[model samples]
Target chain A: MKHSKISNLAFTGLLAAMALVVFVLEAQLPPLTPIPGIKLGLANIFTLFALYFIGPMWALTLLIVRVTLGSVFSGQMSVFLYSMAGGLLSYLIMRLLYIRMKEDRIFVVSVFGAMAHNIGQILTGVLLMQTPALFYYLPVLLISGIITGLFTGLAAQFSIKALKKSPISDSP
Target chain B: MTGRNEHSLSALQWILIFAGLILLLLTVRFFFDLSDGNRERALILLDGKTVRTLDLSEDQTFVLDTGYGTNTIQVTDGCVSVTDADCPDRVCTAHGPLTDNSMPIICLPHHLVIRFEPGHGDVDIIAE
Candidate 1:
């Protein structure tokens, strides 16, 4: 796994930096849809890349670092709870299913994890807002989750394959 | 671990699973939208509690100061909308009007949510 001069911890930090950069940059873009809580989630690429290429622990670390910094930089501290809930739920689901499926099927893991992420956010919103009317966004979120998950998943899959060509991989 | 299980499904199988899930969600959405648009009153909530009730029949506009932010809500033509707001995104202001029970007009920054109480919920005898 040490194909490069970078240490394991340093490499994890590098991935976290990349994830944070993407997260902040993506926030600059206006909402793609009028529906709230919907975004491309493009920053997930680096985290997913870490999950498949580095390790689950490193991936979790990257996700946490990215989301925390992302909220601070975006100047929207209110969304911090929703982001944490979505990020953790997605990571757990991805970690669970990634091992059961083939390595090439990263898209599947991404899709399911993305959906779980949406559900987690909406649940938090409902609880915090104390209104069941928020459930109305469930279907919209699910649909967006699948589409964005496939996009991020495919990007990560390609990056993983490209990195693997030089014999670089990690264990959970 | 290579992670190849006997029960591991192929790409096609995963697609089928996704399709089934999407179909189910669509059905749920259909039912949610099926509620008749006869709602006569809407609740203006701030931080999970109702602050005021608006009669959709009598069009009116008022400024709601939630301390966190402010929103100018307008009720017109049996619909309610946030006409203006000091929130960062102004998503609520842009939400136009909410006439049905499909989805509430939400202002995350202001912690404001305007939802229509369905016809079956109650009879607005006082409004009449």
Candidate 2:
């Protein structure tokens, strides 16, 4: 039992580091669209994997750590609030959907999760700017979220399938 | 295992539903943008307060100092735009121009927002 616990901690720590690296690297790229709150969200691939393979708690921790560290490393501390809002909302929605659906349906969960993340960020924008005009961007964001979510979700799904088939066993 | 297969079917169904919903949303948004008439007035707000209101018909250029940063706004021929900004993101500047009220040009770092208001009556959307 102790050995399993240690392995779990080590695994989660590794995943968190990998997620942070991806987040930082993605941030370095030019904005895909002039519109804010739209991105590839590649780091979420790891979060989805951790959510299904490790557990919800570890996944949430990994998300929080990655967002916090990513913002700090990127030198855009001002965006940390928006990142936190989006990351936490995505994690919660993913967890809720995962509980209701089968493990094989993680891609769907990721789609909804990405939508929730966009909603959360839009809400933050509204709260910060105190304007409903931001809602105009909702449709554009929703479409982007779906497309990007599908990409990351499929990536995660395939990675998990391959990992399961690998010789090294995943930590429970 | 049976539960897994059944859930997979439902997941596929959900994905289809979401895809349709997204398509519908995009359609609605596109129509809404097309139907929106040209706006004549632009309201500039800094930190939730009305800093200036400009007539889009008039051609003018001005520099706004928000204390945190500066933005160069230009109004010409029924359009308004941020030509330059000191904010690191430059998103507002990159946004180019505003011919309608669909999306406000926002510089979050500077707490600056430039939105097109249809007329003077509903300009105070954000209550101080």
lDDT of 2: 0.80
Please, what are the lDDT tens digits per residue for candidate 1 over residues B1-128? 24366667777888788888888988987777776345788888887788998888998989999978789999888888988888666767666788555567888767788887655432222223
Off by over 4 Å in 2: A1-3, A170-172, B4-12, B34-38, B119-128
Position A104, candidate 1: lDDT:
83
DockQ of each: 0.42, 0.49
> What tens-digit string does per-residue lDDT give for candidate 2 at B36-80?
433887789886677898888899999999888899999988889
The global C-alpha lDDT for each of the candidates, from Candidate 1 onward, is 0.81, 0.80
Tens digit per residue, CA lDDT, model 1, A18-126: 7888888888886676567888999888888888877788889889988898899888787889999999999999999877765688989999889999998999888
Q: For candidate 2, lDDT tens digit of each residue in A18-129?
A: 9888888888887676677788999999999988877888888888888989899988787888889988999989998887766567788888889899999889878987
Looking at candidate 1, what is the lDDT of residue B4?
65
C-alpha TM-scores of all predictions: 0.89, 0.89
**Residue A58, candidate 1: C-alpha displacement in angstroms:** 0.3
TM-score of chain B of each: 0.81, 0.76
